[model samples]
Target: MIPEEEGVYVFNREARSWVKISEDGPWVPKEDGTYLAYFRNHICPGCKAFDRVWEELIEKCVDKLHAVPALVQCRNFFFDCSDRTASDTFLLFLVNATPQVIVMVVEGGELRYVERCYGFEIESVEDLLAFANEARERMRKYAEEGEAESEEESGEELVVEGGNWKEVVEKLRKLLLEGRNVREVCDERGCRFVVE
Candidate 1:
């Protein structure tokens, strides 16, 4: 059975356990880690074909990564937005097709989107592994960049370019809360300061 979490849940045949996933929700990611999310449904033949590939990939790469598989049920393109489950998560991620895999990263307690691997693009387990490896490398680079930024003085000003000043201010505030050194934000043309 799937656990009561704000994401998707899929049975890991290899592990013989249900793996909880955080595709899109209030659920936080594993501390400073990466999660591989598989979005698919039982009705889609493509999804079924990719399922075997996913299983094999998991069997081979389980020791090297954390993967979550979800079997979503979406009929007539309608989803219950109020519910927080695999179906709802599939909608949240704008998944219109089955067998889509996304990589998510947790940095500073916030969940961030990394990359995605579509089922049609995956021909074998090795393809999946390569995609996952690339995502992991990107996450590593992102973490390193964030760490380097945090080491700098917090008072350093940041020029945020955007058409919506209010939105930019809100984003800058969020970045500041996330331990980013955002001293100020301005419009793209630098006509006025959005936040200072």
Candidate 2:
């Protein structure tokens, strides 16, 4: 349900760990060290291109992403999916609204996670996290498995139309599945979700 007012919500890996992320005063880094951070006040978080299948979904959906490890917590030009940076680190998604999505990743920043306001029949924290984690896991499998499949198919007659590796990457960025993740990705997309 789209609310008339904006809000903030935080989802944690821990059970029942969804809390309303607060921004009372200026945001102070949790640790006093080098960190790659993406911050902004107001920005839309949705994709464009209504006609395209998943293009609209990829429009305004990235909040926090790091291109590299920093010596200090550096500001990321305060953007809301306006610029897509080539990062070898992590991705941060910023959703603009009350009860907006706030992310604080401490480890495995490279292993990304995606979040958004309630997508399905969600009523609790676990429900929300379940959706987010499922999407991420499935997406990862789609990419990794698809790559493996492509390797085998590379010797075939029809090689994805002149070997468009980039097109394959684009499919992943769009969250489409090229092959089944029944093997690699360890069926994380199939089962083992926080919520069903």
Candidate 3:
């Protein structure tokens, strides 16, 4: 049986036992980290049942990998369970189901969506470990490919002619890659950029 602190959407840290994610202090997904996120809602019985499996997986396998354990809740409270609206965190991960496990890797400022499995699909700890292993492999391969692509693009010249959308985008990307602020880069290029 899981401890009271270990129940529901609780994050276990070395310094703390269980830091519950509250509506006022929601846990934000890190922009640059390897994370094994468990998405769930408080009202789902399946989610409650899967809590043990998630905790067990963390205890047994987290040390073997770089992915940090994270609990993401769509509905922070039972009252919000009926609300169909998703939080920004859910939208960022494209999470649409409860009791789902997703491995996320943020490498070189790029977020890579790795493998995922529903809680019901994972019948045992071994099964969950296998999924994690597969995700790690995929992340490695993706990193290798990204390096190769960057090497090839490094020698290419950034030339924008007649304001072609693709070329303009590539220029902006290159500027951002060079560690220039988006607004500053756009201003230097006489281009207007807006986010949100």
Q: Largest lDDT belongs to which candidate?
A: 3
lDDT of each: 0.53, 0.27, 0.54
Give the total clashing residue pairs for model 3.
0
Task: Give the Å error, residue 129, model 1.
Answer: 1.2
TM-score of each: 0.55, 0.24, 0.53
Query: Runs in model 1 with CA error above 4 Å?
Result: 1-7, 10-16, 20-30, 66-83, 139-196
Give the clashing residue pairs of candidate 3, or none: none
| Predicted structure with the largest TM-score when compared to the true one | 1
RMSD of each: 12.8, 16.7, 14.1
> Per-residue CA lDDT of candidate 2, range 1-196, in tens?
1111222322232332323333332222343222222222222121111112111212222122221111101112112122233111112232222222222323332323323331112333444334433554555676799888978775646333312333444544344223423111112111110111
* Superior candidate under lDDT, 1 versus 2: 1
Residue 164 of candidate 3: its Cα lDDT? 35
Stronger candidate by lDDT (2 vs 3) = 3
Q: How far out, in Å, is residue 2 in model 3?
A: 8.5
- Error of model 3, residue 41, in angstroms: 1.1
| Tens digits of per-residue lDDT for model 3, 24-140 | 222334367766777766545677777777777767666654556766664432113332222434443444455778876766555545667778788777777677756767867
Residue 58 C-alpha lDDT in model 2? 23
